[model samples]
Target: MHIDLIRTSSKSLPHQISETLSQRISSGLLQQGVRLPSVRSLATALRVSQVTVSKAYDVLEKRGLIYCRQGKGCFVADPEHTRRQEDGRWQDVYDDYLPRAQLWRNFDYSEVKYPFHIAAIHSELLPLKNIGDSFASLVTQQPELMATYGNFQGDLELRGIMRDHLKTRGIALASSDVMITSGTQQGIDLVARTFVGPGDTVYLEAPSYTGAIDVFAGRGAEMIFVPTDSEGMRVDILTRMCDQRPPKLIYTIPTFQNPSGVTMSIAKRQRLLELARSYRCLIVEDDPFSDLYFHAPPPPTIKSMDSEGHVVYMKSFSKVIAPGCRIACVAAGGNILSRLIAAKSASDLGSPLLTQRAVLPFIAGKYETYAAQLRVTLRGRMEKAAKLLKLYAPPGVKYILPEGGLNLWLELPASPDIGKLHELAEQESISFLPGDVCYSAETPSRHIRLCYSQMNETDMEEGLRLFLRLLGRFLQMGS
Candidate 1:
């Protein structure tokens, strides 16, 4: 209705009108299924003849830019032409989903020499044989489990086993308090779906897990970033923010947080629980890497301190057992666990019975022995990686040697020309996770996460040799 028409242009009124509307449709200004103004109304608004507007509408209809509904008005059409047409037409109609971890979603790293971007344990260290044997044993003993639908909440035996495991983490839960999910990613998504909504406030660490950031963003939650330090999320800053606008949820990874590899201290954990109690907001504790500690346990999990059922605790076995099994569980005290069960039923009838059963033996008893060996393997890799950094890494690169966790967080020079560094690394088949994706909002990225657990001694050394050289050059260029 608000299109501009030049009176003196040589182009006919109808030709200009159609071109303008077509361009508008081609761009996203007028999205699909939007109703256009009545031809008479548009004609009157432009002070033009109705015939001109009619001609424009006719052209739009023939080209399939829009469809006319009986007794209604012309509406923009779905982007079907994108499939038939080239010239970047697909971009115009694509869903434009942005809440994904860009590294995994966009990159093609199949041929990379050094894949430090990945955060999973090396396949060599995973308990493939144990899990496979467990699978065979389960199928032989319980064929009905493989054939029939599982309880959407999860396997009963698995839940009981997980309940015992939680006792070690200082989280005591009833049988009904625990619900199984595919992994922490799905668990966070379920919690977000159940609690967060548009305009709902959620507090998160500044450099939180990329998956958690994507999940909350996809739910349209207003995320408030609480800064973190060597001890983990700064409860002091969070306290001020909470005083102003109390959030509906506070999500934290108290033990060996991803990307930063920092752990929250016990005092702050207690204070965080206190704040949650004061404000009556739900707290979601994501604890995937807690069992991967090198020297000593980080601290008691925030969930363990919550006696009031204010916390929802998530723990994943993927890091130790196998990511393919996709095993994780959630423990919540209140009726919220029931609501999560409902959401789980809607997600997938249940997680694959095969996978749940496959991980049962490991989680039940075999985990302790396998975990000890896995930790030693990872600690060796971490030590080798640390030595390589000490020998080859340039002066400006700063990092904290974490006690445990897969990633090594590096803080490059403030004027880090990360784009150039990334390009150079890519040329040599070295890949890492840029720190920007770990954040909820745009921040100056002078950080990168390198996973030492993914590569062995020889390969890790060679990859770091090339990477440090390129990084040195990039940092020097910035200076």
Candidate 2:
């Protein structure tokens, strides 16, 4: 706990001490509930007066970094919990872009040996040959199409291709019902903008996808959290809540849900559709990783079960096929489809014509072969990673094993400092998505999301072993 301080600097002794301590606490170097050295002890160790230490501790206490326990000692406090107590809570973690981007972007990939925070297939695994060849063929065949602004409702032929793609997943929507967007996030953004407004209620699962959270919250929607389980979003709870306070729209990632990797039961999905119908609300089903299943396929999508236009189905291909293309499709009928198309046109006119044209042929022909091979590779990585963590993780640390999806969701034993864990992992060139950012409510979260497909087998094994050791040490510190 030794801090280097300048004796002759312009900064006051208390300022220097408080600054150092605050940085440590905020960065999670000193995790929540860990006892801090007493005023006298720290003063003596740093060769400072007791009054100076007291002033520094006072500053920290004001910032909700530490709390004094009369007879016991001073301990690190959870800032999020303190904020909640003061009614100064962040309604949504991704209310701002900087905070959201800071959490997920600008990583030094070269230095990071194991970037488990990344939620896409490894570059080596992407269908590079198929993509390049398809793009080249499309560009050569239709040089003028590349210069054109493509359809706002997405390419008709591509929509037809996507319609067939959805058929493989048990969803049967007409090509005319589909609209293309840059990616699934944009699809969600369009939905939020088209329908949701300030103070409008939107129901999303607890610990849901951060991107969707950002979109809905950015639109000023009053986010209501629906708790989830092994079978995914608790439909019973949703049903109970709907009678009390009905949301304008419901957002759900039913299959291989982001961060949690859980799938909603078929019964639950059907019930959800029924509930939404009864309430006269909308359901936005964001289906990202449903196709990445390990063994048995997940239940038919909510959109598939809906005979009426109650569900809006969105799917992304960027994560698995080719990230740079940023291709995704949304299927909605009637005025809802018209509104999204209008929103999409206002946003960017349309997605790149080249990408739409390029992906259509590849998706029509080679995508199944590519996805089949990818599922096998991803499953192997997932199984081995799961085995390693289950064997070595500290007691009380639990995880959900998914039938499909790239992420491995972790539940830590006690609340270990996630900020501190991130800082420590950075030093080891490892990364994982801290579960705090995934929440709509800013609460103390003891969870993490690790993507197994981010690295090769060698890096995955070595990095996960190192990550486990870090967890063991962190838990031991809590003890």
**Root-mean-square deviation of each candidate, in angstroms?**
10.7, 11.5
Regions of model 2 farther than 4 Å from truth: 1-110
**Over the stretch 1-479, how does candidate 2's per-residue lDDT look in tens digits?**
56655565345778767865664454344557666788988898779999999999898888678898788778778754332232432332112222122222324355787888878788888987888998888778879987798889988999999999898778888888998889898898899989997557789998788788767755656677899999999999988887777879999999998989999999999999999889888999999998899998889999999888999999998767888899999999998899889988999988899888888877888888988888999999998998898778878888878899998899997668887888888898888888866765536678998888888888888899899898888888878
lDDT for each residue of candidate 1 in 1-479, tens digit (9 for 90 to 100): 55545464445778767755664554345667766788888888889988989998998898777888778878888755222234665554343333333434324576898988878887878889988898888789988776888889888999999999988778888778899898888999999998887557889998888788778766756677899999999999999998877879999988888889999999999999999999998999999888888998789988888888899999998756898778899999768898998998999888888788888887888898888877788888889889989988899789999888898999987766565677789899999888867775534467898998777667887898889888887777777
**Alpha-carbon TM-score of each model against the true structure:** 0.81, 0.80
What's model 1's overall lDDT?
Answer: 0.81
How far out, in Å, is residue 470 in model 1? 1.5
- Superposed by TM-score, candidate 2 places the C-alpha of residue 40 at a distance from the truth, in angstroms, of 38
Among residues 3 or more apart in sequence or in different chains, the pairs in candidate 2 whose N, CA or C atoms overlap within 3 Å are none
What's model 1's lDDT at 379?
85
User: Could you say which candidate leads in lDDT?
Assistant: 2
